[model samples]
Target: MPRAVRSPADFWSGALFAGFGIAFAVAALAYEPGRATRMGPGFFPFALAVVLSLIGLATLVRSWLRAGPPPLGLTSRPMVLVLGAVVAFGAMLHALGLAAALCFVVLVSASASSRFRWPRALLLAGAVSGLSVLVFATALQLPIPVLGRWLGG
Candidate 1:
């Protein structure tokens, strides 16, 4: 059906994204040389910022091609859950540690799905969190904190 089309909202977001990228890229220019050749801590951020700015420019171009006013849709439930989990994860990172935090992240993320169930949530959360902890802490030596002082280092 050649039915309906919704106009895109303000291109300001693209501009903002581009602005953030520019800021990061500028900051990265000051990065000091590290062990691996010349690139240091700021290298990735600077590169990412440039990429973000390009994306923003592309989005702005796309927006300019659109015809008229746009309708932006926002949903409450999923937004609340995802944002809440992210905030909680940030807050709990020190105390709860990676394993616990990953569990929370996994379960909360899974719960965002309409098809999510308790059993699946539990299984997936445990498996994903466990594997993440093992790989990061053991294999990669990422210094991921474990839940308790006794259990982790």
Candidate 2:
């Protein structure tokens, strides 16, 4: 008889990784990969897909070799808060602009952690927002405004 999977976490993660890798690899075929000397837009994605597939294969093999506890169930609190943070960022980006959106996302997501504190959350939000503005706005010169129409930019 065939051996069953001993680790649910490994088996599920491997399947998910393999699925994503195959999907990305197939999608990459539509674009030109170019040569190794001068890679095209598709080359990096294709290479990454191959690496992901290999990791998945290793994990799948490990699932059969070693016994492990069953995967823990997902919690709604963290999931909801994190997803909310992403949505908040998207919703606020155009209206409040990048800095505010980044700060909002950080604060909301930080609330999901058990060790969350207001002072720490605010500090982290400020640091990340400032760094993001420095990198994407000042340094990279992305066209996104620091403040939007809602904030009288």
Total backbone collisions for each predicted model: 0, 0
The local distance difference test score of each candidate is 0.76, 0.90
Q: What C-alpha lDDT, on a 0 to 100 scale, does residue 108 get in candidate 2?
A: 95
State the lDDT of candidate 1 residue by residue for 1-153, as single tens digits: 012322355365666777888888888878863555766787677778889999887766656666446546677778888888988888787777888888898888778889999998999999988898888887999865777454454
How big is the positional error of residue 131 in model 2, measured in Å on the Cα after superposition? 1.6
Candidate 2 lDDT, 1-153, residue by residue in tens: 135999888888888898898899999988899999999989999999989988888888888998877779789999999999999888888889998999999999999999999999999999999999999999999998799779986
**lDDT, residue 22, model 2:** 86
Question: How high a TM-score does candidate 2 get?
Answer: 0.55
Poorest stretch of ten by lDDT in candidate 1: 1-10
Give me the runs in candidate 1 sitting further than 4 Å from their true place: 1-8, 11-69, 148-153
RMSD of 2: 6.0
